[model samples]
Target: MGKIVGAAIVSHHPGLMQCEEFRRAMGAGEDSDLIAGYSRLRAKIEAAKPDVVMILDSHWFTTGYHLVDGGARYTGTYVSDEMPWYLHGVPYDYRGHPELALAVEAVSRERGGYNRAICHPGLERQYATLNLIKHLRLELSDTPVVSVSSCQNCEWQHFLASGDAIGEAIRRSGLRVILLASGALSHKFNGIDWKPNHPRLFHESNVSSIENIQSDKGAIALMADGDHQQVLERWQDEYRQLPWEAFGAHYLQMVGAMGGRECRAKGEPLSAYENARGTGNIHIWFQP
Candidate 1:
């Protein structure tokens, strides 16, 4: 049977897309810890020997369906329309896991879940998914990758139910999977004019507000303590107000698949918590 061998909540901020030299220049002589975090995350994933890498992409926002990219193969040159200058001319070639995606869809259907696998090759890719591939150097490996979209209208429970379907699918398949929740924590950007005054762009001080920083730290601490129950419980009252990246769907879905509030996967931080244009970003791996 297929199993989720490992999982991670990782940062895929566009800042990581820039070359190390430019990143160091922006950081006042230090590269973003996320740059090194990718290497360490790669080692952890390698040790898990996962046959498929499933990404819960916060950027792939769908409205009605919890969409899964089931394309047989993906190949193309990419440039971010959102920030073309910062992330451009990136070539990607990766195989997809159609069977596994279809299995998730099937399980979702069986469980009255909303997950749907779209096998069309023409579907566009998102930086949230591609950045991880580039950072992890996934093209050098034989493992197939697939991405799942976060439905824009989904509440925490909807995401959890969809993930429950995915978990059931994984349990029935033969592939070993590594789940990547690719996005940030608190995801509010600073006002445009702030950049000129803030030369130290990547520092935590650049994060939107001290409150956001504390909220992010609190959530991170909860993850480290393997206390997702508290995070989930406080979502509607405390955490949800912080505007998590993509509604925090990436993390909600990942933890949901691992048994939702009952999951006790302690997080081992791979990168220092940092700011990316006022957003809270970090890389943390959860042991399986």
Candidate 2:
């Protein structure tokens, strides 16, 4: 087995828009700290010099229930009857990868249904991450990178599986591996009324939460016991301490996945900053 030489968990905030180097490469203006976060993240990966890097972002893929066939067999989630139709049929075919149509067709046959349920919004996020990876590959010399959006169902399982796959792939390539979980602390979107005037309030609260979780002493403690409500309540209580506008829990799942990794290293406290669109940057990292 290949050794995990380095690991990191970072927020994909738009702060990358500010970096002159990133702007020239991506030909885009910096809008939020999330973008800047990704830019800095890519730099960090290059510096780490890992043979392979695995990036996990919550925004990249949607959660769906469906199966896809890869010539020999069908593979998909069976949680809900909802199938991942968005990935079913596509116009373009990528060589060596599953054909969209075949995969969808196989899923239809196995699931006995044409009612394709899709996680469209989730796929869009995945596409964004893909776009970032493409840019990174193009800008940095050919890095032989592979990307995969975590499955929608039981994200933790998918996270673990992805890590395992990366470990195996690295061993085959005979290179050290680095894992990066790209996400945020707490951020509220969707026009929610909760907006704290000071970014520090949100940042401090989230950092505290993460610290608590890492130490096995916070709301996440309840989460481990399947006490979801209590977990939410605890998070809500933390939110209450901060200004109202801070909201976004999906990012928390990413952190939870990092904490679960057996070979994972300790996480460090992250700083926060505001960007062009008022989106706060919650910078975090975990190393192994």
Candidate 3:
């Protein structure tokens, strides 16, 4: 199997597209920031020479557990003014990558009673990123690409299974390296009536919660006790303390799930661009 060499967690906030201040700092053109980040991120993957790259997003699937089909299927749910679509049937090109699609279908079939519902209707940026990745895969010959959405139905285990599948596929394909996982850290909404200057807000506090959980001493323990409320409360306490620069927690959780692999190297923060509206990018890297 190809070894995982690098990983990163990034937030795909929509405001990134409008943040011109960030563009100038990153020396980027007028294209979308999501596209730029993906380009830079893909460059890192190519430099690492990994066999596979996996991108995880928190806002993809619905919360439901039902076995549908198996093998490589492009099943997704979309909510946009341009195309409002929900795909429940098998993909037309099931024969292209039948095994992986079969695995997903089997899991969906076995996990019945899955609550498949959309939580938000405005997360078009995620769908845009998904399309961008697909386009990149078609244009680039250096790496085999796989993408999965972690909508409500997906748990940590599901993500782990997907990673395992990618590893297995790469081994079978005779690739020597894999670049797995991309996401971000704690992200509190701006609508909560909280100020960045509040004493409770900062990166250290956010990192503490993540470190605590990763160390197996934080809310995960409470979650184990089935005390989701307590876990939520504890997280809320931490979230209330976060500063503007550290608003990437939701993305971080997805990255942490794909742990146990070494990063190639870590990059310095490229830029810290903030706007009058209080959203920006923290461009850093973890090369495996």
Per-model TM against the reference: 0.98, 0.47, 0.47
Overall lDDT per candidate, in order of appearance: 0.91, 0.38, 0.37
Candidate 2 C-alpha lDDT tens digits along 199-245: 43323333323333232234323433444344334554563233111
> What lDDT, from 0 to 1, does candidate 3 have?
0.37
Which candidate model has the greater TM-score, 1 or 3? 1
State how far residue 61 of model 1 sits from its true place (Å): 0.9
In model 3, how many backbone clashes occur? 46
Estimate the lDDT of model 1. 0.91
Clashes of each: 1, 28, 46
Supply candidate 2's per-residue lDDT for 80. Answer: 14
Q: Tens digit of lDDT per residue, candidate 1, span 177-212? A: 999999999999988787533566777778888999
RMSD of each: 1.2, 11.2, 10.3
